[model samples]
Target: MPLSSTQPPTSTMELASPMQVLPSELLIEIFVFCTYNDAFFPLTLGSVCKLWRETVEFSPRIWQRISMADEGSIIRSRFLARTWASKSKPLPFDVDINAECADMILPLLAPLLPSISRWRHFTLTGEREEERTLLVSEEPATPCTDLVINFADYDSDDDETEGRATFTRQYPTSDRYTMTVWVHEIPASTILMPLDFTNLTIFECVFTGQHTHPLAVIDFLSVCPQLEAFYFWGWTHEDASLTTAPPTVHLPNLKTMTLKSTCMTRSLLTSIHAPSLTQLYLAHLNVDFQLPPYYSEDGDSEDEANDPSQSPSSDHATGMGLRTFLSRSRPALRVLEMDFSDMRTKDFRFVFSRLDVLEEFLIVASDMSDKVINLLKPYESCDSPVRVRLPNLKKLALYNCQRLSGDAIVEAVSARAEYTDANASSKLQTVSQVEVVDCEGFTSRHGQTLAKTLGNRLRLH
Candidate 1:
């Protein structure tokens, strides 16, 4: 990292450069920005001039971030790691190495990986299982504020792929290194149980296949009691032989939750009591619309395939679980979005009966019908917001609601739009926007009626 003899000696260095005249603090920042103490900075910046050379020699904070990506030779990378760590002493290290051979690089980093001070950011992204061992086998002395691990070869374009699990601390203190690792297989352990889940404000986990059990996920949510936003995408159904009730956990701080196609969808909703939840998005929760007209919403049929909402597997909590979670949490939900759901009308009724404070409701590819739309028909002459069915409901959007008719939706919107307060003041629950998309029965006449009533607030597609 020394200046080569090719450059003139320090005493005869160029004198009129702006960089040479700038304050040492600004110059050091520029150095840190040029390279986060990578292999190139020392040789490049140190050889820039005598002032730059002295600055690099003296700044430890500038060497704080030691990161490398895709090095051809692991041996050369290891040498750089040791040198960077040695230079970044007395400062917390943020070492990120994204390479095919990252599993081997960790051992070379040694005690730095485990130092409580080095708990700044340790991360991996979708590699082999050997890299997953880094998640906990050499656990840090203290749990880091931020840790990201992807246990699948996740592709954003593919919905079937296993997704990433991210655990990030809302307030990260750079007192130590942070570890973020992405491994291809879920670690064989109890998913790093020893780490402190309380530090996480946002926790996301994906169970795309049968490799992860429901209990592990349940146990995981139980520890993150302070989570503000939780996302779960489980695709596997329980084995028929493994029927058991999953324990529920109360997430008092959780405000937003998104659940996607999964058998444990109901179990998770049934198990978690998120009283503070305000935004709820459920997608493909129940995927069957082939039931007979006489079939009961209770799913009393002996054949399981007839009712996709009915879990023939060990997941005893049926589609009713969605209703249960909503009614129980009783959070003043502001946004409720359900996509590709085949949930019964009664489930919709349950939600409508409970969430009077809902401001926006978007249902896509749902089994919503005329009866469901009729549920939003609040009295036209109500002088108070409290008397309305959905007093806070202002935005209504229906997408691919095959069973819904334009007349029912238009009637609902017209009835709900009448503020009609005795004080001549608009009620807070009045309909402000209505969007109807891909509903075959939603004709142009319905669009005109709603357009006259809602003006630009009406969106017909």
Candidate 2:
């Protein structure tokens, strides 16, 4: 076989690629992403060719991450790791090795002991309790010098820790350390994760498991009394029953919170007392919205989703999750946004009954009716139950709310914006900004009617 006949002309081949034209920097980055999963990536990259071997040897960032998968030959793996790590030179490298593999990987790496203090990430698995840390300073941490630690995947139960990241930091001149733990995939641990939650101010976690439920995340909040912001994500739709569901987290200083994933909002709202919350965002949740970390694409959750009590009227629905949360928290919430949460007609009406201090309200892709719109129309009469609904609402956005009617919109906006009385005027201010996007019932007739009253305040998209 002649070489000329076997290969295509140079012009016909793809240009500026790995073989001959890419810059070394770009090539090294591409290599890092491509080979990060391979345990013995460095050795494999070096064996490819002279150029790659040189590139692998010279690029310290490429050498920074060393993952040693110990098969049968401990000696060979150790020697290869040693040679590969040497290329990192003075750069602090991240290392992952199994202590079960003879447990001698560390001993073999002893030659580099002088640089131990400089190691950025060091993971010794098997018998070793998985912990990766960074010592920040001699002094303690304060609110001014806040230290943020994203402790992802604290449990190696599923062997997903390859992507797990952990780092530590400290500050000087303070007496206490305010810690923040951001967990992904819901790592297993006690309610506190064995850390002091006294100073925890921000709590965020993402999950997809059955070992523990979102109930645990809700329970964890009880300790973080000083939290300012809380973010909970993912789907875990098993029957949520905690071993001891006694404590309800009281976040006195909490200002913002986002509850996403199916059934998550419902689960957490049952046990939270944030009297100072200002903003809240709920996405992909419904009455029985139990996703495994807790969202289901179909929005049809079994067992818990069909409960009538979950969507009862405000006064009668004290046991309702959202109602309970809103009642207990008494959030002077400035912003309330819900997306794909399947909020029922009664549910949102129930929600609005307590949010008299709410300013900005946005509900997207919900199946609400004209009846729900009545909540926006506040009457002067203290006798009216709807009078207390959204008195301070400033901005309203209803997008993809298919079930709402144009008549309802016009009536609601008119009542709130046009309601001017000499005696006992109730609303702090009418809805200044309104955005109604991709709604079926909002026809041009509806627009004309609204534009007459709300010259520029109304927006139809």
Q: Against the hidden reference, what TM-scores do the models get?
A: 0.57, 0.56
Root-mean-square deviation (CA) per prediction:
14.1, 19.1
Q: Highest TM-score, which number?
A: 1
Reference-based TM-score, model 1: 0.57
Query: CA lDDT of each candidate?
Result: 0.58, 0.58
lDDT against true structure, model 1: 0.58
Model 2, 1-461: lDDT tens per residue?
Answer: 55688789878885655465788878888877766687467678889888899988788777776665445554566566666567776566776766543224333333333344445666666533355643323332222222233323435434654444332334354333333323332322231222223233323334434233555565556545556777655553545433333357667777877766534455567578888888888776544322233222122233232333233221121224566677667778888887866555555666787777788999887766777787677655666544547777878899987878888998887777776222234556666788888899989998899888878988986
> 372 in model 1: Cα distance from truth in Å?
0.4
What would you estimate as the lDDT of candidate 2? 0.58
Worst 10 residues of 1 by lDDT: 128-137
Error of 1 at 351 (Å): 1.4
